[model samples]
Target chain A: MAEERQQGHKWTMIVDLDKCTGCQACVVACHAENNVPSPSEDEIIRGRANHWIRIERYWEGEYPNVKARFLPVFCQQCGNAPCEPVCPVYASYHSVEENLNVQVYNRCVGTRYCGNNCPYRVRIFNFWAPHFDPPLEQQLNPDVTVRGPGVMEKCTFCIQRIRRAREQANVEGRPLEDGEVQPACVQSCPTDALIFGDKWDENSRVAKMIPHERQFKLLEHLGTEPAVYYLKGGETHVGE
Target chain B: MRRLASLSLRQRLILGVAVVGAGALLVALLAIVIAQTSAADEQPLAFSHKTHAQNGIQCQFCHTGVAKGPVAGIPSVEKCMGCHTYIATDSPEIQKLQGYWERQEPIPWKRVNIQPSYVYFNHSSHVAAGVSCGSCHGAVAEMTVAKPVVEMNMGFCLDCHAEQENKDALWDCTVCHR
Candidate 1:
């Protein structure tokens, strides 16, 4: 029983805001990897687009001397997740093995309570039945389920990839190596903006980068203790 | 319709009972057919596991992916022809298999047992964990045609997983759900 209580690796992601260009590569990669359907133009206009990750751009300084700051935001995978408890059906819960928030699509009754409770506003409710046109259906990832209508989903930090990595590691009779599991967002980031690894591992890139002076959680004061950390962006700004 | 309406209340009651009885009988017959179909779906070739097992062939020889991947893969037509080339050239099933190989068309064998798409069941993990094929698949060696011996459901899976020493990882929903 005590062995079961032991928390394994703390999977964390450190996003270097300085490196982000708001290119939306990570966003596109996420949609492709997770089988998230692209919403219709009208649906997107109505704010029904299901982007697991999105670049939040903020304008700095006056219009004449304006600087664009890109902040890529997704599910933070909080240690004390607000969404977990609010899920009436226990669909949105933290996995003990993975140390990440998991959303069981089959169990979710779509109360949207988890989406509402999320401070990061990462949980997305499936407002309509997903439509994949023609050849697009063939590209759906078999590892990840194509979530149906009336289910709440969010960025899982690519839990399917994590599971695959772990299974391979388990079969090989070795502990999971650092940087072994790369999420779709991390893999697609052209500027190396998203860094993902086990923070518990002292040698991991995330562990080494996590102690930077600019490092801050999304909502530190709210006490969410999010796994994702962002580096402050002002230092790299030109023409200061 | 008018003649039926003109019948006595007692006669009408008897007619109603007779119609209900016939409907129930028809439903029962349909259910039996469905149950049989699910147990052993129609296969292109009537492959018998008993004959193969009795001939000293191992299950792993045909199902090469059973211990390696998520699925216990169906053997290719080439794999079948490898043995059928010299073993049983006269057999009708062997001839049918040869026809598929000649045409280079895959035999669309209907799966007898299948889990829901949502459930991420891995054959390798279970095999590595020392689960016998018969545990979930029943005694295929004795079965002439493949049939679902056990219901592949959450409760059926949990029954064995609960017995394992490490309950945390096994019990976690994401272990199978995600």
Candidate 2:
């Protein structure tokens, strides 16, 4: 049984960067939750750190009028995903069930085509076998697989946890409840900047939030139709 | 008849040598199997699972992190000393534990349960789903040492999930893979 499909459910997230403190909690939480390999010190220095969701810092205006804007960017799971078509193997594909982009590691062969084709530069390649120092290795989340070298990996919206939560509810003979299966980034966000849920359900938070006046998608002109939405910054501090 | 039998002396020697070699090989194989099986059961130190369980020490006491995190971590020496400092001061085992704690060195407990690197098994999810530690670990409360009772194979895991009657958990390749 496919488990009564939450009919017309399209998962989505709306990140309000104005509320985002740029604390990087979502980034760290994503790393721990997804089991993304930690790059070595040298890799960090080379700007090769594997961050599925990163807060991109941008400087605007001159000194007195200067302001910093941080945007958290990850796999948009675009309806017309640029990364999907370039993949030689069908490693990257959009799921019909949740309208989520799923990255299957086993199916992936080391093709850099997807990485080069991505506009946001979110996709990262594994150059060497990921190693965790001794006891630190024990800290890895058993729910997520530790990827090895020569494979490409990006965000999966913490699909493993979602599957677990849904299965547990089904086994108990109940419907999937709201706030039951939250992505690690959503759970760990101290400022509550990230909201995730089924976009198709009119009652869902994500569905309700998407229509806000400030909402906009990254590179909307390209018509990528990313599931993720962002709220533009307000004019409260525009001149100060 | 005597001439004919004496002419095949080389054949008799070859047959005799082949029989001896086969016998030796059989003995070696038997010894190797016995040694390997015995090693699996041997404990690094005497540990009574029965006593700990009976004393009301929850499985999470020693195997921490089963609730809020992925790993059900093995207890560090300091965690043991939190109670053992007064509980078993005279025992040689306690003395060893204390020595390690004094030096601030964690005890290198040999892991009895191991899965392949490709697979991801979260203790928190299982524990949250009401799966007892005993379900997979066996009757740890009755044993003196931990031995793997269930083979931690992909098929073994799939079989357990299948019994749950939840298709959501059963067939997803990404459930265990990244």
Winning candidate number (lDDT): 1
Error of 2 at A68 (Å): 1.0
Query: Candidate 2 — which residues are off by over 4 angstroms?
Result: A1-9, A133-135, A236-240, B1-116, B119-172
RMSD of 1: 4.6
Model 2 agreement with the true structure over A84-159: per-residue lDDT tens digits? 8888898876666556777777778989788898887888899888887777687898667788789898988888
Which one wins on DockQ?
Answer: 1
Tens digit of per-residue lDDT, candidate 1, span A16-120: 888889999999999999999988899879988789997889998997999898999999999889999998889999998788999999999999999998888
Worst 10 residues of 1 chain A by lDDT: A1-10
State how far residue A135 of model 2 sits from its true place (Å).
4.5
Name the docking class for model 2.
incorrect
Task: Judge candidate 2 against the unseen true structure and give its global Cα lDDT, from 0 to 1.
Answer: 0.78
**Clash pairs (backbone) in predicted model 1:** none
Question: Candidate 2's error at B34, in angstroms?
Answer: 13
